[model samples]
Target chain A: MPAITFIHPDGKSDRVETSDGESAMQAATRHGLDGILAECGGNAMCATCHVYVDASWLARLPAMADDEDALLDGAAAERQPASRLSCQIVITPDLDGLVLKMPERQV
Target chain B: MSVSGSPVTGGPSAIPHLDVDPFAMNFFADPYPTHEVLREAGPVVYLDKWNVYGVARYAEVHAVLNDPATFCSSRGVGLSDFKKEKPWRPPSLILEADPPAHTRTRAVLSKVLSPTVMKQVRDRFTAAAEERVDLLLEKRSFDAIADLAEAYPLSIFPDALGLKPEGREHLIPYASVVFNAFGPPNQLRQEAIERSAPHQAYVAEQCQRQNLAPGGFGACIHARVDEGEITATEAPLLVRSLLSAGLDTTVDGIGAAVYCLARFPDQWQRLRGDLSLARNAFEEAVRFESPVQTFFRTTTRDVELSGATIGEGEKVLMFLAAANRDPRRWDKPDSYDITRRTSGHVGFGSGIHMCVGQLVARLEGEVMLTALAKRVARIEITGEPKRRFNNTLRGLDSLPVTITPA
Candidate 1:
C-alpha cells in the first residue's frame, strides 16, 4: 500500500496506506483519519472536504472541474489556485506522497 | 432580550387566548416557550396582536398542514391577507396554493424534481461537499455559518437549478425574506423587506425561460408548461420554490447537525465509529433542532382543538422545533443523543407539504459526516458556539471545533 501522511492543524502527523485507486478522502475515511469530511460523499455537492493542495504536487493532479471550482467559491477557507476538492482528486501510484493542508472549518 | 419582566395582563407578555401575531418578536426569536404556553392554554390560541390562530401542540399543527382543503393555501400562506397586501411579487405557486390546484402544480414539480432525476446529479453533489470539507480542514478556524453553511448551499443549489452566476448572492436573503413574510409584519419583516430589495430583480430575472440551463429544474418547469400541466406564467414561481425551499433550509439543517455534534461529543464519536450512524445523526439533529421552526395553515371552517374553537380562515402555526422537543413525545426532550430512534418527529413539515427536498438534505449530511468521521478521531469544541439571527431557522452562526485524529 502506498503511504499517505495527513498533517493535523496542531502540527501532528498521521500516516495511512492508500489503496491504489482510492481518492485521498476515501483513503483517509477508510483509515479513520479525522481531518477530511467527504460530505456529499464525493459528489461535489457540499464543500465539506475542502483541502489545500500541496504546492509541489498541484500540477500533478487533474484540473478542477467547473462544478468543483464553483463550489470552491463557497468553501470555509479562502480559495487558492492549489485548492482542489479531495473528492475530485484520486490517488494513484503516480500521485504518491501527496500532501494536502486542511482548512480550519467545513461547517 | 428578556420579556420575563413585562406585564402579563393583556400586555405583550400575556399569551393571548387566541389571535396572536405570527411575526411578533415573542414568536420569532424563541417560539419554543410560547409554544409550550399555547399547548397549555388551549389547542388553539388566538394571538390578539397579529390576529392569527396559533396551534402549538404536535397533533393539531400536523393536522392543519396535512389538510389543505379545510386549511387552504389558495388565499396565500402568509398573514398578508393577499387581498390587502401588495406582495413584492405573487406568492409561491407551490407553497401558496391549495391542493387540486396545488396538487396539479406540485405534480408537475414532483415529476420534474423527482428522485429519479436527482440521482443523476448525486456525483456532482458529493464532489462539491468533499472539496469544501478538504479545504476547511486546512484552515482550521472558520465561522461555520458564513463559511460553510451559507456557502455550500449557494454554491451547489443555484448551479443545480442552472441559475446565472451574475447577481446570485442575493438568493439566500431573498428567500429568507419570503419565508419570513409568511408571518405578520414587524421589525423582522421590515428588515427582510429592506434586505430583499436589491436581490429581487436578480431573482426575477433568473425565473425567465431564457436564463435557465437547457435541462435543469428551471428548464423542466417550462417543459411542464409545454405538457399543459400549468400555464407558462407559473413556471417562474415553481422554479422559485426550488430556489427558496432548497437553500437556507439545508444550510440551517446541516448547521443544526454540526451544533449538535459539537454540543455532544460522545454522539460524534459513535458516528465516527460506525459510519452507519451518519444518517441517524442527521435525522436526530432535525428532530432536536428543526430548521423551519413554524409554518402556518389557514382553516376553511370552524374546528375544535383542545376544546378551543378554530374558525375558518384562521391561521394555524405549527411549532415543529417545539414538537420535536415536546416532553409529551420525547424522553429527555432536550438531549442531543444520536443513539435514540428519532424518526417520527415532524421537523420537515408533515403531510403533502412535507419537504420534498428532504432527501437532498440528508444525502448532503451523510456524505459530509461520514467523511468527517473517517478522518477525525474526536471532534471537540474550541470555543462557545453562536446561533444565526433568523426567526424561522434554529441554527448555529458559528461552531468552533478542533478535529483530533485517531
Candidate 2:
C-alpha cells in the first residue's frame, strides 16, 4: 500500500493509503477528503481533480498524456509547472509517499 | 485496442437467460426491480427477448464503455447492427463513429463545448436561471417539468446552439425521436418517428450554416470548417450532432434534479443551506434518476466478463441506469443523497464517446439549482408526478410541486 499526502490550499496536510493501481484522486475521494471533484471519473476528461505535485517527485512521474494536458488547460484553478490531474496519477510502490497540493476550487 | 491476443475460449459456468423485454413500457416505468435482478443474475445475462446480451453490473458496464476498441460504437450504439441494417437517418459522425473519425469530430466539439466556452456564457446562464426561478417562486405551485425543466433549457440552450427562434419548439421531439430510434423497432419508436416529421425537418433546416447565428456553438463548429479542419459537408453534421445530442438530455437531467429534491426533502434542505452544493446536487439527481437509461454497444470481438462471454458481432445492451444503482459500487445505492460523490456514475456514459456537451449540462444544472436554493425553502409535491415514457430515457412528464419560499 502507498500512502499519499494531500496539502490543501490552506496548508493543512491530510494523508491516506491506497492499494497499488488506484489513483490519488480515488484515494482522496475514498477517504472522503475534500478538494477533488473528479466529475469525469479517472478518464482524464475533467480537470476537477487538479493537484500540484511536489517538485522532488516530478522526475519520477511519467510524461502527462495529451488528453490530461488538454484538460488541465481548462482547470478551474491556475495551471502550474507541477500541475497534474490527480486521477491520472496511478498509485505504485515508487510513488508511495506522494505529496500533493489541492487547488482552492475544482468547479 | 482491437483483440489480437489468443482467442477467448470458455464461456461462463452458468448464464441466466432473462425473459425480460427491456424496451417494454412497464420496464421503463419501474426499472429498479428488474435492474436489481439483472445485476444479481450475472455480469452478462442473455436477453432472449431481443436475442441480445445484457450487462447490468457496474464493473462490466463501466469496463465496456471504456474499452471502445472491444465494445465498439461504430457498429451503432443500438440493437440493430449498422453492418447489416440500413439506418433511417445518417449515423452521427460523433456519436456512432470509431477513432480517427470520432477523434477528429470529438476534437472540434471538445474545444467548442469545454468549460472555457462556459466561462463566456456563465453569467448569461446564471441570469436566465435567476429570472426563471423568480417567476416560479411567485407561482408557488406549477408543473416543474414544463415550467422549469423544459422551459429553462428551451429558453437558454437553443440560443447557445444558434438555433432560430421560430422552430425551437421542435428540438425536444426531434431529440426524443433520435433517442427512441436507438431502441428495438417497436410501436413507440414508430409513433415517435411518425409524429416527429416536422421536428425532423426543423432540425435539418437548423443544421445548415446559413440558419445559424454567429458566435454560438453551431456557427463555432462551422468556424472549424473555415479553418479547414473539417469539410463544409461535415460541419452541418457536427452541428446536427450538437443539436441531436444536447437538448433533451438536459431537460431530463434538470427534471430529474427537481423531482429528486421534491421527493427527498432532506437533501433539498441541505442544498438550501448551502448553495455551493448546486453542481453536486444536480449530479446526484442525475445518478439517482439515471435518465439516459441504456445504450447498446456491439462487441468487436469476443469479450469475457466475471463468468460470461459474449461473441463478436453481438449486441451488448448496457443498462447504465442499473449500473448507477448497482449495490456493488455504490453505498446504499438506491438512496438519493446530494453530498455523495458521484464521479464514477455512468450518467453521461463514459470514454471518448462520453457526452461531449456535459460541461454545458452541468452549468445549466448548477445555476438552476443554485437559484432555487437561494430563494426556495421547500419543494412540496402537490399532485401525482407523471412519467414521460420512452424506450431509452427515464424522466418526468409532469411534476406538480409547490415551493415554500426561503
Best by TM-score: 2
Tens-digit lDDT track of model 2 for B1-406: 0112122345434567777888988888778888887888778788878999889999999998999999888999988899999876888898999998899889899888876688789999999999999999889999999999999998899999888889787788888998898999888888987787788788888999999999999999999988988999999889988888788899999999999998988899989888899999999988889889999989888877675767899999999999999999999998999989899999999888888988999999999999999999899999999999888988999999999998
Error of 2 at B186 (Å): 1.1
Worst 10 residues of 2 chain B by lDDT: B1-10
**What TM-score, to 2 decimals, does candidate 1 have?**
0.73
Give each model's whole-structure lDDT: 0.72, 0.88
Q: TM-score for all predictions?
A: 0.73, 0.95
Model 1: per-residue Cα lDDT at residue B61: 72
TM-score of chain B of each: 0.90, 0.96
Runs off by more than 4 Å, candidate 2: B1-12
